[model samples]
Target: MFGVLGPNGAGKSTVLRILMGLWHAQAGSVTFQGARLPPPYDALRAQAGVVFQRATLDDLLTARENLLASGRLYGVRGPRLNERVTELLKVAGLVDRADERVVTWSGGMKRRLELMRALLHRPKLLLMDEPTSGLDEAAFRTFWVQVSRLRMQEGLSVLVSTHRPDEAQKCDRLTVLDEGKQLVTNTTAVLSRYVGGDVVTLEVESPDVTAAVLRASLKVDARVVDNTVRIEHPEGHALIPRVFEALDRGTVKGVTLRPPSLADVFFHLTGRALSSRVSNEPEPMTIRTEGQP
Candidate 1:
């Protein structure tokens, strides 16, 4: 599994559209298996499966019917198609809901159905856009279990795009992007190469005061965001006691120290705040099945 990971408006979906032959890059071209991808994707369409960020199913159609429709679109038919659909439905844990219309299903169920529908033709490459969006931890893990099984058994190449940092951690490999530019690509184990040491985040009564005091006395670099004092230190545990000792009593309320996150890596690279929820409009991070924009 590969992930194109980034915050909102980072152009992860744009890259995916280019890869799926739905959009053209302004400058560079895309190559797969040493062959340049041309526009229209006449030959590639049949070999690639896609699960959009939104649910593409007809709510009025039964789950099984939806799969049949999608299968026929890919030229799958007869006993082979029926057998494939049945096999996928069972694998995706939707056999019980196969005959039921999707309108009554939960978000998790809809997502599972979409995944199954995407594989109706058994495309070699699967492209998922925010496949886990809106799912709780349990549902998210459940969905990935099916994906993992497919990878292990079928040797499928899955490319997924995600805004959630935790979801990106599940990728076999991922690329971090910012403002449409690629930052780095590496395995998750070594992705932290960009982040130096541990980060200690403190929620104090006065962030400015705490930051100023730390800089003036301990000479540590502290930055304030949303009334929180955040510091990254090589020896974060050692700096904790020193920070508390240097500050006046009751000046500090809480402090947490841990390894850096992908957000921290983004901040380190571009100095941009990654946690800001600027867009209420959901961009392919997950499926908003109600069709709200």
Candidate 2:
């Protein structure tokens, strides 16, 4: 599995749409299996499956009807189509609910139905954009479990786009991006090493001043991101007391020490956190500890 990982508005969806022939790129050529694909990309479309960021099901139709209509669009019909639909419904664990109107189903169930529809034609490549956007932790785990089973069964090559770091970690390889620009591409293990050792994040009233103070006093590179002063050091446990002694009393609001994560890697490369929440929105200046979740 390959992942396109980044924060919001990072062009993940645009890249997927371009590959799916839904949008046209102005300058660059698109290729699949080393062959250049021109407009209307028939070859790529015929061999690829897509699950868009948003839901796109006909609520008025029954789940079975929806799958049947989608199958016919790909020129799949007759007994083969029926057999395929039955197989997919069983795989999705929606066999009992297949005859019900889609509008009555829960969001996760609808997402499962969409996944089955995407695989109706048994395309070789599966492209998913934020497939688990609103799923709870349990539902998210369940969804990916189905994907893994399907991958092994169909020998599929999946390309998924996600802003969530935990979701990206599930990929075999990742391409991290910032504002549509590729920062780096590598395995998760290699990328985590970019910020060696422990990550010390300090929630402070003034991020810029605290960062400058740490750099000037300790001679360590520090970055200010989203009201937090972050430092990468080999000895985080020993650095906390020095940080308090260097800064004025009550200057620091909170302190968190954790091992390196993909979020830390993004911050190391760009001096910015992975979150792209609106600037006007008030976010609590609390970073996740080692095992808060």
Candidate 3:
């Protein structure tokens, strides 16, 4: 799996459009599977499966009818097409609801059916834009699990574009984009090495004061985020105890040190936070009962 990651207005959608033959570029050449896609972009379009950020299925059509119609674009018909539709519906767990109108389905169900539609012709590659845009946590997990398993089973190549860092991390490799330009393309492990060290987070009573002390007295460049003082250095774990000892009695509340994440790598390279541009789904937080506070 490959990932294209960037913030809004970063030409991510344009890239997907170009790859899908939706629009032709005035300049630059596009090649797919050793075939040049210039004007008559048939070869490229013939074998590429595309899933857009939005649901494009006909709401009035039944799930089976939608797949059958989509497949016909590639000249898929007869018993072979019917068999393929049946098999794909089973894969998407929509076999029981195959005859139901898509307008009656949930967002997750439509997305799953869209995926099945994409795979109808068994294209050489799959291109997805913000594949998990509207999925809840459980639905997102289920969708990804299905895709990953399908990739292994079919030896399919998937290229996904997403603003979510955690989602991008799932790819085998990624290309980071900013301002419609490519920043870097490499394996997750190699890109993460750019950080060169670990990250330390200190939950303190006074974030600004603690951050000021770290910069002036400890000579560490610490940044304050929310109520935490975040420090990134070559050896964060070793400096944790020193930080705790230097702080006032009640100032230091908690400390954690860990290796840098993909977010750190992006920030270190781009000088901008990915979370600031994109949003992350927070895990479900439990509500406090009486006396918990």
Best by TM-score: 1
User: By how many angstroms RMSD does model 3 differ from the true structure?
Assistant: 2.9
Alpha-carbon RMSD of each model? 6.8, 4.8, 2.9
Cα shift from native, residue 9, model 3 (Å): 2.6
lDDT of 2: 0.88
TM-scores of all candidate predictions against the true structure: 0.89, 0.88, 0.88
Better of 2 and 3 by TM-score: 2
Model 1: per-residue Cα lDDT over 169-271, one tens digit each? 7888989888999988998778766777998988888899889999999988888865689887898999999998998888877789999877677677777
**In order, what lDDT does every prediction score?**
0.83, 0.88, 0.84
Q: Identify the superior model by TM-score, candidate 1 or candidate 3.
A: 1
Steric overlap count per candidate: 1, 0, 0
What TM-score does candidate 3 reach?
Answer: 0.88
Sorted on lDDT, highest at the top, how do the candidates line up?
2, 3, 1
Q: Is candidate 1 or candidate 3 better by lDDT?
A: 3
> Model 1: runs farther than 4 Å from truth?
277-293
Model 1 clash number: 1
Which stretches of candidate 2 lie above 4 Å from their native place?
Answer: 276-293
